[model samples]
Target: MPKGIYNVPEAYNEPVLSYAPGTKEREQVAAAFKEMYNSTVDVPMYIGSEEIRTGKTRDINPPFDHKKSVGKYHEGDVSHVEKAIKSALDARTKWAALSWEHRASIFLKAAELIAGPYRAKINAATMIGQAKTVHQAEIDAACEFIDFLRFNVEFMTQIYAEQPVSSDGIWNRMEYRPLEGFIYAITPFNFTAIAGNLPASPAMMGNVVVWKPSASQMLSANVIMEVFKLAGLPDGVINMVQGNAAEISDTIFDHTDFAGVHYTGSTAVFNGIWGKIGQNINKYKTYPRIVGETGGKDFVLAHPSSIPAQVATALSRGAFEYQGQKCSAASRAYIPKSIWPEVKELLVKAVKSMKMGSTEDMSNFVSAVIHEGSFDKLASYIDAAKKASDAEIVVGGGYDKSKGWFIEPTVIETSNPKYDTMCTELFGPVLTVHVYDDTKWEETLKLVDETSPYALTGAIFSQDRYAIEQATKALENCAGNFYINDKPTGAVVGQQPFGGARASGTNDKAGSVLNLLRWVSPRTIKETFVPPTDYRYPFLG
Candidate 1:
């Protein structure tokens, strides 16, 4: 719909079936295809019984099963957070009083449910709603969230076991306590696992949560809620609300009872929320906790000694995974001149091999971008990059939206580091390749830190110890999560804490104990057998 971008071809409107023809196989595939297509059209899921008049709507285009309805949400203004806060406040008392074992039990149960019966439904919903390949959807709906559930339970147990302090004849212990009030969780559409963990973390820590999921991810959210319910999560312990930003913000920020906010989205929105909280800082009974992860223009650096084949593989996954929609997706590549030719050829070949088609096509890797609005933005960036400098479109750089939102996996070779595409966060299937001279590697590293405002995730590919050390130090302040010879995108739950600094995020790395820590407040409870009357220790005396 927007200028410069094209729509998906009409030929891809229907699901492409390649199974052996038979009554059983035909019926099964036909039914699956039917369900997939039906999820594309917008369907409303009301939360609080208020009519949402916001004109915002999803485009249920083809390639996506047109008959499949997109989930709609009717979330109205919570002019007063008083009720939601009260709900959470009350819920927290009972939730927190439960032993760690109880909480962990339910969490594990939820994970089991997710992996068991809900897997197919969740996978299907994600693939249709987000246009994810079957494997990608399965990874998100089943694997990632399941991992988060199991990991958080283990991590929270460890945090609880940490002891405070003890002195001669005096023993003191410190315990983590949940905020007495409600926690508001605002999640992003990119990772549904984020949606599950953001609210669940705080809930597990004995705080009640109010979740505001991204509209694009409502279907996934619904499936997650189902899992939680099946796990026997207490009624009203977690509430899902969907609405425009204004209504949600007005409700949550203005509430005096809100104890914390967990958010992941654009920097602008995060900053705006921060400012509002600052303005009303004195209105709250307790200091509110704020944790967020925002945007990123992650980088992938290739050294002279780096293998050309490995670099290509990493870049290909980083640049095009989820259509470059991931916050940590590598958007920039700085390849040394020595390995530039080899890296370039391999990368181009790898890009060419990526299959582009409907998600139902199991082999198709490239699917439609989430919606038309995003497609338009991607097109603008590509066009602006072309006009602003001598940037060349290396591989693919167009869109076709006749049936659904689809963009070719695009790569651009730019001569100028300051090219708009190189600097900006293009959350689409687009990558900018910049070749650098080996002699000027240090200067290039400096340039990387300087040009990009985001520092979420960055990687370097090299075996040289000195080179790795130098680059690491130089780019130390560049990314929150740094990698060596690894793709920045596929961050594991327990191993690599995912998040960035600067414009990228609040540095609250998800999938780690750090994220769970953000949900709680540690309080020291000192008990002495003799009730020390004087505030003097044996050492001081």
Candidate 2:
């Protein structure tokens, strides 16, 4: 047992690996991907210390090549969900009573494993499983997740160090107690980091969890479970389940032990989850905590004084990375009319130059979208833009589903600011451009602010300080993570502390102490050095 109150090492963002040509890291990840691709994997749902394999299973494959089957994951029914929840609740007392430092060390060890021995394997799984490029996997599965684990340990100390001030006669201590029950982590498929962080972050704070990964993300999610085991995380502390989402969620949410939900996905699904929780709130032991990051019509605003080249770069990268599935993807752009021609020319050139293909190819910048449904949805939007008089496809608007679910990085120039593409969250490789008069900068800011029902992320580029200040203030409530001269996507773990307001989320600021605070209830311990023998006030005397 460690004796003294200790401080965690200084936290820093994990550096992204370039995986350039002839690099050892590149070779390692490639080898891992090849081995995993050639072999079939079987994943089992975890309940307590047991690995329960239901005979019912579903086939999974890479989005880039759906014909190639890579693995199968067991699917359970409502009974398994009930068993998992019961196991979690049964383990909650032991988990919550564990010392905070012991809990923190488990995740810190997991981070080191990710940064070292498990790096290539985890990145390989993400690239093959989620259709992420090597660079994308490096940043997300390898780096960002590592940052979350390491920084979350440091954040635990911060939460613990916060104590109430004591007077001369008393010694006051603050104890941060983990929630009485487990958390339900509803994770998305776009990023392996998020799938890992959603469950483990709360687990690090001593709260057990029932984690449900996106059915599309099972391959990498299994790898995360493997790493946690190697890190010596006790069994029953975190349970993984896969099955009919409706059956599973209904079973879990209806349980009285359900404590909280950590979700990242569509607004509609999140709203449904919220409604379910509300309807069952009276049955739960405690008022469950809800922390979610949902849909966004994120935008990029460029002033006339800004460089067209820089604006073009941000749009190209922001709107298309991970095939624009990010919650912070720049789906809309507000450009000044004075610079529209130049910006359009540069943006079109960049979009046309991007390569879309399988992630196995190192040079390919974009890969196939996650599934056929997303591809069909994007193709419909592109066809609609082609027919509409106000909307024009400037660069690329092609879709081919013969081999993989591929949609070209498309740029839609719309005359109407209120166009569906401008105001809606298409969540694909579609960027809508709406040009406004440069003189009415303030009005443009307001239009940008008021256009979207979602306030997740937005960026502004301007050479003039006054315009920067004006736009920043005007669009303050419009974005949770605002950027100046940078793309709205790729928020670092500790530095950005990302979340949004309004429909975007509760703005709990994941990857920060504020987020960890959600899992713990603070109790102030007041100790009196001198006991008052008489229970009487001065007025009584």
Question: What TM-score goes with each of the models?
Answer: 0.88, 0.98
lDDT of 1 by residue, 440-498 (tens): 88899899899888989999999899999998999998898899989888777777778
Our tally of clashes for model 1 stands at 23
Model 1 CA deviation exceeding 4 Å by range: 1-71, 79-83, 532-541
Clashing pairs in 2: none
Evaluate model 1: give its lDDT. Answer: 0.77
lDDT measured at residue 521 in model 1 versus the true structure, 0 to 100? 84
**Poorest stretch of ten by lDDT in candidate 1:** 7-16
